[model samples]
Target: MPNFPNIILFAIPFFILAMLVELFVTAKQHIKSYEMKDSFSSLTMGLGNVLLGFVSKALVLWAFLYVYDHFRLATIPIIWWSFVLIFFADDISYYWFHRVSHTCRLFWASHVVHHSSKHYNLSTALRQTWSGSFYSFIFWIWMPLLGFHPAMIMLQMSISLLYQFWIHTETIDKMPKWFEAIMNTPSHHRVHHGSNPLYLDRNHAGILIIWDKIFGTFQLELKDEKVVYGLVKNINTFNPIKIAFIEWIYLFKDVLTGKKSIKNRILYLIKPPGWSHDGTGKISNDLRNEWLIKKKTYDTK
Candidate 1:
């Protein structure tokens, strides 16, 4: 199989063209979800990701190949059924990687870059993480060991990512219920980007929605509640470097000087973002639980 870079190079032009079309449509339709500085920052982030990937992917590929050559259970051939099998396997891998990224402060430090932008548009999809490629691929290391070829896994992973590109938008609202039920549509993805308490850390599926449904991370978009894109506390800056590493900086700062014990400092890295030893931070579930209590009180009243 061809390398992931070679396979994904074919999609870069299409990604650019699609962004242009989204920009055109936004202008024509009076959509105000996009901003110039934000879009440029996103593009730069994407370019940085690709440039960094050219080097980092080599290390990741070496690790995958080493496992594939030595410990693979069986030789998985490049057959049609193999693609089908990999689709589910890779999607599940992505679901867990995404979930873990949101939960662990260490991983969230990298993933927070993608969510740094407040805009919900095609360009937001281009807001890839510079540091995510370092640890995110750990989620799929088992695939090569389970007999899937490294190239095959890389190819399917790229396809999954390409499929996700278009869903990061405000143009298409809702799809057919059946389609939305089965696939990750714009509506589903919008919920994922939402900073709303109810939507935080929900809808973490890739390519297919079944994993989210089965795993209880799925949340439907409510007709009465609008989705607020970006983090609960917005970063409020356009610097790509800051956007990429601000979370890491904050994590280290908390661990070093947040008045926490050494054990708690370590736990802060493993615990969800927004966790604090002094009872100040709020994790996603904490936020969701607060929302539920408020909602229940409002309903009762």
Candidate 2:
């Protein structure tokens, strides 16, 4: 198998070229506005993500190779079926990982970077988490333990991620019902990026849309409903360091300064983003009320 770095080197240029073509083709339709601030942040975050992925691949492979050698299981040949199984297994793992990333404070710290973009475009897709590897490795460890070769696990995951890149665009509005029903498409992903009340965390599929539909996280795009992208309380800063650590720092501060109850403290760590001690933070009833009022105004107009 080619080195992972080589694969990334080959893919990055092609991906960028494709994104540029999409941007040029769609620029005339006024589909969405590209915020320069968010676009630069997205590019930086994407590079960070690639770095984290490289590090993670090295670590996971080291662990797997050591364990396999120690246990005399290194002789196992790479099974082609592992690739097939990985497609499904990786998606299932990604579903849970994505859901948890949104729900858990520590995980959300990294995942929020991707959601920080206020625009939905190919560039927004490139806006990835710099620290996602910290928790994401937990999901894929099962692949090796289940007897899948480490090399195959890495390859399939890369391909899965590649498949996901195209879905980030707004250029392709809605696909056929069958495709939207089973797979994650641009429409499904647009809903996921939306900060609208109806769309929050609605589509968590990695490769397949079935998980969201089956688990009740699925939502359809309503005609004439415009999506408001970005978090309830936008970060409003461009510092990459702050973008990565601000939520985490806040989480720790809340854990230390707030209630003493173990359950409440744990809840602070595991609750939805912007959840707080008094239940009155940014994502609180206040924001929801404002959103509702604005929505009503839009409806009446």
Candidate 3:
């Protein structure tokens, strides 16, 4: 139970400075990167997330400590190599957690807050989920049981979070070829934020892009088709409270008011977003396939 300094807290000044710089640069390039209302909403959500973390983090720490105390396979020392191992372990865990969040309605209810903003900029990085911390930590609980110290696991998680923040902007385009191939850059992450059919549910990387490449979830950002940020059906509001909880409201409304059977109601909760029991709703794969087919037909013509 070693003490780990709150890396994210220490980085707040850097976050603000980076966003200010991005605001100035994007304006210079005539890019409408930040709308005042949207950016303000994002900042508010980030503040709420930080405040909620006080309660949620305690539960997460308790869970990790419980696993470490009762079930750890071996005690991993806090050596330099342990940091490297945890970096990968925590990242892969993040990949799955993020992937599941996109595919499953329950998790997506919380994660949708991040995608609610229609604009992609450094501020969008601050558009975090206020509720994700409560249950998302479950994805990392296995690390503690695997004998990695809780403090080390948490530190690596923060590092991954920090690494991801910069990739949220449009200021930097592609990185060097080798770096782009291995790491998640702005180009890769732009696709993740896009509402475009081909980009949906793709590139669920933390620090490395290799996981998406290996898992067949990678979609390169297309020069011809520019990335359109936000959800497939945009909420179109800047109200922070609405942005934070709208998806959950929609999810429960569907589950509770539908005339479908109990099984279908359960499916509403567990199935992917845009999943309808009647086979009418289109998920990411459905949209991507339709796009691919249309592209193929056009190419042939």
Candidate 4:
């Protein structure tokens, strides 16, 4: 496996400092941004993710190396041009991984930990998945096979992660119109975090907002519809352990007990969240369509 300085370790102080600044600003501005128990739960989840990452990352590196050693098309040199390419390459990979995580129940089981918090603040960014590193690497493993060095792929991944931390806060509002058009800003991410029917599963960008716009998953933050941060069905708990693993618990329970058919059981894993064997449960698109129809009717009235 290739070696690179772990950029995330160095960013720890910056993360804490930024959170403190945001906490102070929100309090002074009289914005209800952070909750004591909620922020604490997010911090605890972040700590667990870092701890679990030690083992999970080792496995990821091994897999990347295995593929790179055997199947690489060509050895891409780590020059300036390569870095430029990998930035976009890794980000698009993140776009797809994030999009899939929202649309597939198996991946969502881990990704939901980040959205479990009802409070959207700097601390909310720290609410990462303990299980994601184990399986999420599958999304990025192709980079190595494409001849991008593991070290380059890993560095860009960290850079992308670092860039995203700032966008989690509600402190900074909109960026310049041009910047907002091209890059992911707090405004864009706020919609991503929102549980509103119109906002669910939208804006799955990593660093660039362009992918969402290109892919038709983009939903602008509406002035009238305030973004509500949390799951459509909030977990209603501050326990970090529960917040991290509750979706997995629910997912397996649904598969094991509710349905008897093997196809239905498999669908419970592959299908989006809120998908049901019967025509009862509703996913994000379902809820969004219903809300849009009602809004259209009200507007005409």
Clashing pairs in 1: none
Lowest-scoring 10 consecutive residues by lDDT in candidate 3?
Answer: 149-158
Cα lDDT listed for each candidate: 0.89, 0.77, 0.93, 0.93
Per-residue lDDT of 177 in model 1: 87
Residue range with the least summed lDDT across 10 consecutive positions in model 2: 67-76
Better of 1 and 3 by TM-score: 3
Runs of candidate 1 exceeding 4 Å displacement: 1-5
Tens-place lDDT per residue, model 4, 32-129, is 99889999999999999999988988898889888999999999998899999999999999999999999999999999999998989989999999
Better of 1 and 4 by lDDT: 4
Which whole-number lDDT from 0 to 100 does residue 160 have in model 1?
93
Model 4 lDDT on a 0 to 1 scale: 0.93
TM-scores for candidates 1 onward, in order: 0.96, 0.86, 0.98, 0.98
Q: lDDT, candidate 4, residue 216?
A: 97
lDDT of 3 at 39: 95
- Deviation from native of the Cα of residue 105 in model 1, angstroms: 0.8
